[model samples]
Target: NFATLPIVAIIGLTIATMGALTSLPMFWPLPTALLSASVAAGGLALINSIGQMAGFLSPYLVGWIKDQTGSTTLALYALAALTIVGSLVALRVSRSSAVKVAGPA
Candidate 1:
């Protein structure tokens, strides 16, 4: 239902914020990084909004695929394929070139 939207947003955004806070220290002097806190925050929000577009479009796309195929099987595979591809891409992320500003306790 439509109520799921806000709930997903709430959880997703909290996790995203935690991720940003945890990772910011690794961006010390990168060309795209080294940003002020506010600038980084605004950038994160912008990126999050763009990524959330999938939430709106993916369901509709899956439903249309279901109508065409007469089954949820293909739709489920499509979603699973996306997750797999994302995991593969994530595996390729290079180690951070910038050192952490805060050392572990």
Candidate 2:
């Protein structure tokens, strides 16, 4: 599932450009796969909310980092680092069988 995140992040870093548009689609199935059909809607909603928040804040954060550092390198690195952290979290989630919800009734 999220096992692909680290690979995508590495690709993004190598490209040195934002790959959100392309990479986002790969993650769309995650919530559905992880949650029961009953709570899948909520899981999707939560993911959407987080995505929207990131979309709204990321530019500002990038700009701030650029202003402070006089370059976008640090910002990109920061994003990559965060991506790695997310990958680790995803790994943990994938290992937690107890978090998997029951199938549709």
Clashes of each: 0, 0
Expressed as tens digits, the lDDT of each residue in 66-95 for candidate 1 is: 899987778868876885675454344324
How high is the CA lDDT of each candidate model? 0.62, 0.74
| Model 1: ten consecutive residues of lowest lDDT | 91-100
Candidate 2, superposed: residue stretches over 4 Å from native: 1-26, 98-105
Mind giving the per-residue lDDT tens digits that candidate 2 earns over 60-99?
A: 9889999999988788778779877876776677567435
- What residue pairs clash in candidate 1, if any at all? none
Report the Cα RMSD per candidate. 9.4, 8.2
Error of 1 at 59 (Å): 0.9
